[model samples]
Target: MTYDLYIGDRMFSSWSLRGWLMFERFGIPARTQPVGLYSGTMKQDLEPLAPARLVPVMRTPEGTVIGDTLAMAETLAERHPDAGFWPVDPEARALARWLVAEMHSGFTALRGDCPMQLHSGYTDFTPSDAVCADLARIEELWSLARTRHGPEGPWLFGAYSLADVFYAPVAARIAGYGLPVGDRAAAYVARHLADPAFRRWRALGLTKSYDPMPYAMAVTHGPWPGPAPRKARAVDTGPSENTACPFSGKPVADFLELDGRVFGFCNPACRDKTVNDPEAWPAFMALL
Candidate 1:
């Protein structure tokens, strides 16, 4: 069908992740493109992206471009009904749509406070009451779906469907941050945390630039205590050792922090690990 999908860093691009999962899970043929986010150039960078400050934009051979995660997924599923992107049962499909939509429009408090950061390293930052309330609401929503739809499958409404894709990023955060959740939600997360598509996406997320720093980079890179300063011991090195790759912990210029910028990314996603935990960042420099 000649589909081209644009995405952001796997670490921080939650919306993009959902759309990408749909394409991957269904084995759809598509080309993937990355746009940097923390480079202090989102508006400029996305100028060519056509009408938006977002990622995960999809374009078809017919010259139609679709924005927004759910909108894009729905469009693709419609064209490839045989692909079975949505649920087959009328009742189940309806419920799935409702949940997916709920995710799209609601969760303002959580979205504002937590913000999604796949690579952001966890800091001891405390979430606000509003944010916590949002989390609680989200948990309740997930709990209801599984309870009412558990018989269908292990997924929200049973089986891996669009609803799960819509909530995929949230699910990732719940697992990564170890957020407060109920038993059912926790079980669902355990299974989802192990999903092939999700794993593959996260694995790759650890590989791309998030444009801004991703929380994941914090997982591997840090204010590396560059070797304990030579204690007046015979001067050792002519030149200091090079910094390591933030994402893989490998020494490479490909993952660099310029001038000790806190949020700058070798790849935006890598930076997510740091940005997610602002408290962990010394607030002395700006990556963007």
Candidate 2:
């Protein structure tokens, strides 16, 4: 059975990204319903899911509405035992829960100052003292997780777990705003930005237009080196056929040349995914 996921604008709604990942990355089937995060209809959009008036709200197949990222995560974990939402190891599981909880409640400065914008990266954005402190705490938690279960993979708990889901948007904020994170954290952010699920979400987000622009900063370092095709503005004269994003069917101004064929995607994440797995390109094209 498919679950109902209510989400806000993908490009800016950090929690929405986390909620989408809970199903997209896992085996859970979910049908997403877009909520008007910027259209001044969030209140009306969330009438059915009352008492939990927030983006990324989830209604179970059985019609149980769940709010809050942490609570939703826990509920999904409880419902799907074999999904591996949490780490398998006892210690890693406990620590992963701790990380998710911290991210949900803590890091006010970083959350407020550097909102998640997948458009472009700020070249020389400076972090406030509070933001810096939050980054340090984040690194500390990541380091601890790596030291414990990192012998397996690049993810926080070795495998893709809820810890990664919770921090994925935080990673986006760091990379998008060009926050001064250490090498380890920077690497983690890179990984999150490169995930295919994130790519699909971002590509779809590109199809949406924002009025007045959400997070317009005066001191933008530059367009974040994200999947957005604007970075490829220099190559405007690509093949005519490759002018559409393969994932979302949107017009792509910028495209990537892969293996004798030009492939265009709305963002770098989609291009990277197709480049890394050329075999999957046909499936994505079929969707378009």
Candidate 3:
């Protein structure tokens, strides 16, 4: 059940990262092929790989083709419910779907003003009124969602679910661009950064491949605020780690540290499930 995923660099390919991460989380083995966006060769490059002008196009074993972030995530959600891609609660799941949909269809201002990248660093750039409005709304959503779900888990919902996946790019954009999220949203971003999937994503972006989209590549501090560990650099997960996940793309809440270093787990149960199988761990770990 290998899937063919088209993606951009780690620092820049939030779209591709989401799709690939979902693919990995569900255990849908995939052959990853990078397509350089904004490379001028993208159109011609994708003709053979994806045929669409997007990077995160996924071709499934059933020969079905899906593109766009929400669509791809939903498609997987429908087909891989056993993966728990969506939240379990009917209401939570519905709200999750709504948020992902909104992120896909809306936020024109932020998308335009803060393009995705991870190159140098951030500058004090002002968002247009429209982008600011989008940010404000996003922050509000986070605040509300966090307030409601915080008691259960740290993610947008109590546990990590599809909603988090879709909005992850927004967190990255805010981090890379140094946007003012006030308090609640800023805290939300920190939690996201500590998520195993995100930490892996950030670590990879620091050294090797990053999303090359102008905004994504412009990232100077990487996602984490402190300097990346000089010794931590030795873990060569691989050039492709950032593009997907190394463990399950959706690292369970228990497996990750607050800083997302993949240190020891809370107890022995996790060690048996995720640690015993080296091969299993590497799949998701490789992506990190």
Point to the candidate with the largest lDDT. Answer: 2
Which candidate order results from sorting by lDDT in descending order?
2, 1, 3
Indicate the worst ten consecutive residues by lDDT in candidate 1.
Answer: 224-233
Q: TM-scores across all candidates?
A: 0.69, 0.82, 0.71
Q: How far is 64's C-alpha from truth in model 2 (Å)?
A: 0.9
Query: What tens-digit string does per-residue lDDT give for candidate 3 at 1-288?
Result: 667887776667778778767765456678877776756777876886455778788887877777787777878778777888877878777777778888888898898778765443375556678888999999877776666654555778887777888787788778767788787677777666555556554444544432433543332453244223222212213222133233333333333322235433333333333332222334434433
Top-scoring candidate (TM-score): 2
Worst 10 residues of 3 by lDDT: 232-241
Local error of candidate 2 at 65, Å? 0.9
lDDT of 1: 0.64
Identify the runs in model 2 with alpha carbons over 4 angstroms from their true place: 227-282, 285-288
Model 2, residue pairs in steric clash? 120-223, 120-224, 121-223, 121-224, 123-221, 227-267, 227-268
| Residue 71 miss distance in model 1 (angstroms) | 1.6
Worst 10-residue lDDT window for candidate 2 reads 227-236
**Tens-digit lDDT track for model 2 on 229-257?**
32222233466356667667778766655
Candidate 3, lDDT over the whole model: 0.63
